[model samples]
Target: MSEAVISLSNAFIYQKENLILSDVNFSINKGEFVYLIGKTGSGKSSLLKTLYADLWLEKGHGKVAGFELENIKYKEIPFLRRKIGIIFQDFQLLPDRNVLQNLRFFMEAMGWDDKMKIDDRIMEVLELVGLPDVLKKHPHQLSGGEQQRIAIARALLNHPEILLADEPTGNLDPEKSIEILKLFFKINEVSDTAVLMATHELGLIERFPRRTLYCDGGIINDLTGNS
Candidate 1:
């Protein structure tokens, strides 16, 4: 049997007091690559937030990277996050710090204390993202593609078993977006890290088809397919 890195059975998703999605059930196995598609206001972000423990899972059974979402405590959230990588729509790199510092800060926050290992991991992820030489550049210094690459590298620092990306290529041009997607596939192949990327780009999906989960009408539909 395939190992499920993310599993949700009879889950209810919410944003504050608003109920967004209900009866959600799905399991993303380890080393799989799945796209999340939906229109705006379709609860895509809410579902992703719930998976990452940003928004609490109010009802149902949910497990991510071995952590039980329904009963996860406040203190355990950080540890849960360490086993799962998260990327955002906006390249949320710190403007004041260079790439190395930004990644180092994240590693430190994740409890990485060895300076040598931190530097090595940063270099390794950057190489994987095809941006090994941007360590000295700040967020403002790099182009949109470069900044997003840095974000990808940052997420990979802990050797996460699954990557949860919310509109990772939303800010880039079509060419850059494709580049980023290709890089993501490469990472997926090489590291066997399962990816759940939320995107609205039907064109990209058409071009690079894979198993997909669609969010719409307050529900999630599995558009399962061969990669």
Candidate 2:
């Protein structure tokens, strides 16, 4: 049986006093690639934020990468985040730094002490993402797809158990989006990392169908129940 990477049971996600999603319940198993599909403002991002501890779990229970969310302490959040990777629509690479330097900075921040180990890991992730020679390139020197590839490489650097991607392909063209989606699938298959990717592009879903969860009207419907 596959291990559970993310789980939410009767959870309520809120932004301040406003409830975004109600009674959220789902389990994404390890090595499973699940698509989170919904319209804009339909609570996809809210649910992902709650899982990553960006937003507090106001009610019920949630667990991600072995961290309990219902009662997670404030200071314990960083520790929780270290176990999972988060990707965004925007490729938030530092402008002044080259790709290698950026990855090194993140590794240092993530508490990688040995320089040799960090360098080895950088190469590993770059190779994993199928771009091994762009370490010297700046974010501005790369195309949108390359920048996103760097973001994915950075996300994989820490060997996260789960990757929480919010609109990762939202900013790319159709071809580029398909390439990014393929990379995600490759990562899921090769590294056994569970992925919960939130996107509104149903075309991508139809092109690369996995189990899908639909968010609407403050409710999440698991379209592939018991699969």
Candidate 3:
């Protein structure tokens, strides 16, 4: 069996006085493609935030990408982030920097210093995402789907064990959405990178069925009803 890449046990999250997530429990094994579905305010983003250490764990236990989340030191967050890739709904690419520069920034931040190796890695991931020709294009120049692909390439800079995508296809039209989804499918099939995506698009879920975790009524239900 594949190892558990992310594990949550009775996890709870709070935003000041109100509880965002309550007693949430789910486990994502290595190379598994899982969908995280919930209505607005269902704590989908908060849950992802908690996993990536964006929000603090007020109660319960959670482990992500081999790092224990609860009571984790602030300084360790960067290290934890290194093991995971996070994709946001809004492509967070720099407005001025070209594709290669944006990717290089992340590599540099992650302590990659060799210029030759950095260029090679950037090219490798861009190719992996089918954007080999986009290295010179600015974010504004690329189409919506192309920009999202660049974001995915940026996320792959570290070859992370897991990819946490929050509404990755939210901004695209249906056709483009499918294109991005297929890209994700290809990535998972080829690299065995576990993908935990939070999305409202049920069509994609129906089209490419996989393990699902549904969030509703302040509770998370693993569709398989298993831990």
Candidate 4:
């Protein structure tokens, strides 16, 4: 087994007065493809948010990609984010930017200075996500699957240690969903990038047969046979 990339101990998350997640705990091993399954409003998204530092932890300990998440300094967020890739159900691609430009924007924001290096990396990741020829295509021009692939490629640009995908295939058709899942599987097999995906699709869950983390009643349960 690989080392633990993400570890949570008695973690609690709250929004205003509501306790969205309580006493939740789990450790994600490096290169492991795990599924976070639950119904809506069941703290699935909240957990991912906390893992990526989008939401601050209200209590307990959490570490992501070797960075402490609890009480993490505001200035360190960008650094933490650099080691962790986050994918949203909504493709957050820039409307005005083509695929290449959109990826360039992220590399620039991350303080990448070499133009040639940035262009090369973008092409490499685009090809990794199977969108080599779509660099000049705008998000609107691509199909749902293509747009999502671009998003995945953008996430890979930084070579994140772990990929947190929140309902990545939610907007895709079944065929496209399978394709995206296969892409993620390929990523894990090739790069050993740990993937923690939150989704409501039980069919995919059963088909892929990864370790399962089910969120229910303010707790996380590992239903995989190993445990």
Candidate 2 vs. true structure, TM-score: 0.98
Residue lDDT tens for model 4, 90-209: 989999999889999999987888999999999899888888998788999999999999999989989999999999999999999999999999999999999999999999988888
Tens digits of per-residue lDDT, candidate 1, 1-227, equal 88999999999999999999989999999999999999999999999999989999999999999999999999999999999899998988988999999999999999999999999999999989998898898899899999999999999999999999999999999999999999999999999999999999999999999999999999899987432
Worst 10 residues of 4 by lDDT: 218-227
Local distance difference test values of all predictions, in order: 0.93, 0.93, 0.91, 0.91
* Error in Å for residue 83 of model 3: 0.5
* Candidate with the greatest lDDT versus the true structure: 1
In model 3, the runs with Cα more than 4 Å from the true position are none
Sorted by lDDT (best first), the order is: 1, 2, 4, 3
* Best prediction by TM-score: 2
TM-score of structure candidate 1: 0.98
Cα displacement (Å) at residue 28, model 4: 0.6
For candidate 2, write residues 1-227 as lDDT tens digits.
Answer: 88898989999999999999988889999999999999999999989889989899989999888889989999989888888989999989999999999999999998999999999999999999889999899999999999999999999999999999999999999999999999999999999999999999999998778999999999999998843
Candidate 3 per-residue lDDT over residues 7-81, each given as its tens digit? 999888877768977888889988989999999889899889889998888889989988889978999999999
- Which scores higher on lDDT, 1 or 4? 1
lDDT measured at residue 219 in model 4 versus the true structure, 0 to 100: 84
Candidate 4: which stretches are off by over 4 Å? 225-227
Please identify model 2 stretches exceeding 4 Å from their true place: none
Using Cα atoms with residue i matched to residue i, what is each candidate's TM-score against the true structure?
Answer: 0.98, 0.98, 0.98, 0.97
* Prediction 2 global C-alpha lDDT: 0.93
What RMSD value applies to candidate 4? 1.1
